[model samples]
Target: MGSEGIMKDVTKQGKATVLALGKAFPHQLVMQEYLVDGYFRDTNCDNPELKAKLARLCKTTTVKTRYVVMSEDILKKYPELAVEGTSTIKQRLEICNEAVTQMAIEASRACIKKWGGSLSGITHLVYVSSSEARLPGGDLYLAKGLGLSPETQRIMLYFAGCSGGVAGLRVAKDIAENNPGSRVLLATSETTIIGFKPPSLDRPYDLVGVALFGDGAGAIMIGSNPILETERPLFELHTAVQEFLPNTEKKIDGRLTEEGISFRLARELPQIIEDNVEGFCDKLMGVVGFQNKEYNKLFWAVHPGGPAILNHIEKRLDLLPDKLDASRRALMDYGNASSNTIVYVLEYMIEERLKNIKNDQEDHEWGLILAFGPGITFEGILARNLCA
Candidate 1:
């Protein structure tokens, strides 16, 4: 379809909104230098001088530290558990489930309370996660704990990796659209701490996995007016588009390893995104009936997958140098919170953008929410700016 045809199809409607959002972050900060040096020490590279060089590469004052569930002292207490080979399957599952449950509940409750909603209003619980997994997964636990409808439909989209948030939102939208009166509560909780394998230093890209990542959770409530209403809704869902590159599955893959789950970051990822982003975005805009230049006031709720991925997106999209400041700050403050990174970006916008919005009628604002992950896929959403 032509540009006008695309814009006509994807323009905003007046319903289906983000009623509320909430997030939880751990207290600890894993400094990049410390993490890099830890990896260098573990690798025992023949070139001693390379440690400083690698440290400088990973170091970023913009992302000074990352949060973790386990403290240094706590990790010291269970040295055997830190290694990949020492822990039994049951032990690993139990520990990870416990940590994820706690973080999920903390963030979920904060979100529900902030939005002034309750379990009674929720008809569905959807969770998106990649770091760890279990049956009856995190969403089931949330429904039970919150005393939500036992009949509440549970949808768990696991293993989508960093891009899970965008995909999850799409799933939630589908659910809400199908079940008109139902409100869907979406939560993304990741504990990379549980997947820590101290011996991954043999592979250079594996080093990137170990040095980056933190524990956190974020929750958002989405629904039609039939489900609920909010005095200050974040935004109405306009349209969403998702695309996957053919034969490029290896570009980004996360899977279970003996040490836990690990992510493979192929060096070719930057080039892959650079080559496809323009066309991918063009088609996405077609879905929403707009052009790239028309949607220039973008509040990039980008998944801070890694420094390299973010840099690649910046150059390919021709974004300003400081365009990803919020995402970069989140990486520095929280490391990569997986699906929660975009939530943190939304949080940042709430803090900064909400303040300046004129609380008046007839002022509909717009922005794009974008994220990418495994399948070498990309997802984009056109949203009516609630904060603006």
Candidate 2:
């Protein structure tokens, strides 16, 4: 086929669309109000000052509750986890590897069931996580647990941080669009277990992480052409783009140490993202043939990295108070589950739309999904609501 003919053939296959979304969380739930006492008790910390600081942070994060892999049983079983200077990397990895794999399997099963397709129909799997470090990785385990074909093409994205979910979806979109008849399952799972540490005066970021991060898994089914009889397209992904801000490499940093992974977030991180987001989003909107469009005309599914990041984006874009409701609600209910948080926000959007539909409310046809992570990366997707 000539270039034009090939282009026509590809176009006929259609853009990648989101057929379904599913999310799973660890069994242990912690309320923010009570977490301060338990955390201090678990770590055997006697510093009243640090406990007060964390209490304030929890309140400000707007996270009412969070799920975590860390529980009393596990902590009791592995007491070294809460100690200050223990080389517990092996133990942490063991716990997280199993936890993330199981969560991914549950989330994927929910997504496939919602997609109403046979497990054998999944042609590709894109698994994303930052909480587990192993040679074979969780993708292999997830595929086996889900009973996907041995030949299922698989790619694993590790340590993408908060943007992993959107990054995975972008990659899945390419696979589905390029390969006709492809059904891609994108699963993102994360836990704070690997990074959990005793609060220290030296590592203030650890407290911030304790206040902001949570554990969860999210899965999405993506395909270019859907079987109308058995599949329904929720969001049609039109364009996806990623950009790394210059001179901001040190804004967000994570290191793997003998103890476990450690993270540092610059106080100016939110400001840096706010400064660059408008231009980055404009680029994404331009690809969809919108120039200087009204921001409120479209819905938003932004990663709620923290209350400040969401507030910054809202203020920068001049968006309405409710423009980021889904993001805020997800943060309040689940905290920031790293890459998995975006999936929660998208799921919230889907549920809200369903409620709206029953009430005869209208929804916008176009929307955006945005996430930020290490590398100071910005991931954005221009999407259309087929269910509208």
lDDT of 1 by residue, 119-217 (tens): 676778888877556776877886777677778889888888888887888888877666656677899888775566554336445546555677788
Worst 10 residues of 1 by lDDT: 1-10
Listed per candidate, the RMSD to the true structure in angstroms reads: 6.7, 3.7
Per-residue accuracy of model 2 over 180-274 as CA lDDT, tens digit each: 87889999999999998998988766888999899999999998877776678999999999989888788898899989998789999889988
The 10 consecutive residues of candidate 2 with the worst lDDT sum are 1-10
lDDT of 2 at 310: 91
Could you say which candidate leads in lDDT? 2
Give the number of colliding residue pairs in candidate 2.
Answer: 0
Question: Which stretches of model 2 miss by more than 4 angstroms?
Answer: 1-11
| Alpha-carbon TM-score of each model against the true structure | 0.85, 0.96
CA shift at 350, candidate 1, in angstroms? Answer: 2.4
